[model samples]
Target: MSRKEKTWWWVAGIAILVYCLFPIAWIVSVSFKPPADLNSGGFLPDNATFDNYRTILTGNAKDLFRPALRNSFGICLIATAISCLLSMFAAYAIARLDFPGKKLILSTALVVAIFPVISIVTPLFNVWRQIGLYDTWLGLIIPYLSLTLPISIWTMSAFFREIPWEMEQAAQVDGATTWQAFRKVIVPLAAPGVFTTAIIAFFIAWNDFVYGISLTSTDAARPVPAALGLFSGASQFEDPTGAIAAAAVIVTIPVVVLVLLFQRRIVAGLTNGAVKG
Candidate 1:
């Protein structure tokens, strides 16, 4: 509130902004530089072009790995949709309704969330192979649901608890059923939380490499992260760094845009019920 404090705050804000943007600035800068200059010690590109993007995009079908991008997009989007929907209802019930052993169930979900994902990978891989789901998109998705589901439930439950029970009671008094109140009234007020949870779930699935790499074998089922590993370095396929940088840029752009667009909702989701209404 004082002049000195305000000046210090402004200086701190600029410092944080530069720190966060520095990596992005470097990535974009690298994306333009020639292959020869990729390792060169330079902050800015001396010879920049779109050739990296063009080369990767127009490369041969066998080596380009474009199909992996499609796979990642389709799988991540679908998994996020399902995970968000399931989390909303679970959160609603836990927040708004009383059930036998409700606290126990919530406790179990939290415990499961704390368990290391790597610990289950072996058994999961075995089960997937036994059930004939191994090396398939669905196989990867099933595990991904686990990754997104617990957090989604936790986040959504916190959000729903912020809404007063009186709102739902009022809706019921006006002839709305419980489901109707949830669908029409509660969901609308919780739209920001839902959007925020969906984005989180999407990114969880999108950025996943462990499951994608272990579960899927072929290009058709493998996601972009796995494909990136496969495409890098080749005696026959020289000049892969440029392609790698280009792919990194392409994969990163959408997430950055989405985060910026829905940042308001994300902040609301994180802070919605911090203070009692």
Candidate 2:
């Protein structure tokens, strides 16, 4: 490419980056803006303070951030853990073990993944309510399993396929049983892929807004996304734009931190699995 072309490419790339990041930057920036200048129609505020954050952190209100944060974290953590354990073993089985209907099983996984979970939310909600699981973390966790399991199976299956059979054969030669070989050999080898899938599952459960909003009304079970919607209620605060932005920033920090912490493993797992055999 010519110098002009290279310059244009760099400019285009920076513009795209800025466009993507601008909304996120604005959320964080407005979180620090004084309520007086909250929606002052400017990117930067005249006076900035941590009052919005303090309100979210220490303010005494029916729907506060701490409990919502705790609830979201707990639900996401439990859902991710359950999904990861089941997916890891399921992926191993699907990739390595021979079965009468392996192809049928994989095809079913694909079909289930393509279906939207929203369609069944009402029925699930009704069932949970009937069984007294509604508005509870267990209720949320059950639905989340359906959300993450298919993707985890597919992604982890790809990683498992990349493992050479010779590794398992060697373990078997050393008197390791089938389960032992998988536990000691295959699992450690697929650690990066396992972590990557867990992160994906956690984020999916965390960002789920539809189920969180529809299934729970009380603050005790509602997550940050659901609770954030309360700021714009017709009967509540006149204009809570700043408070909403502040809450958004607070909710986003945990996800950003998780991504940064596991970025290396995630990238490596994806690359290794995606590369041609």
User: Which candidate tops TM-score?
Assistant: 2
TM-score of 2: 0.93
Pairs of residues clashing in candidate 2: none
Clashes of each: 0, 0
List the lowest-lDDT window of 10 residues for candidate 1. Answer: 55-64
Error of 1 at 200 (Å): 1.0
lDDT of 2 by residue, 61-97 (tens): 3346778889999999999999999999889999998
Q: What value of lDDT does candidate 1 attain over all alpha carbons? A: 0.85
Taken over the whole model, the C-alpha lDDT of each candidate is 0.85, 0.86
Give candidate 2 regions above 4 Å deviation. Answer: 61-63, 232-237
Off by over 4 Å in 1: 60-63, 233-239
Q: What is the lDDT of residue 83 in candidate 2?
A: 94
What is candidate 2's local distance difference test score? Answer: 0.86
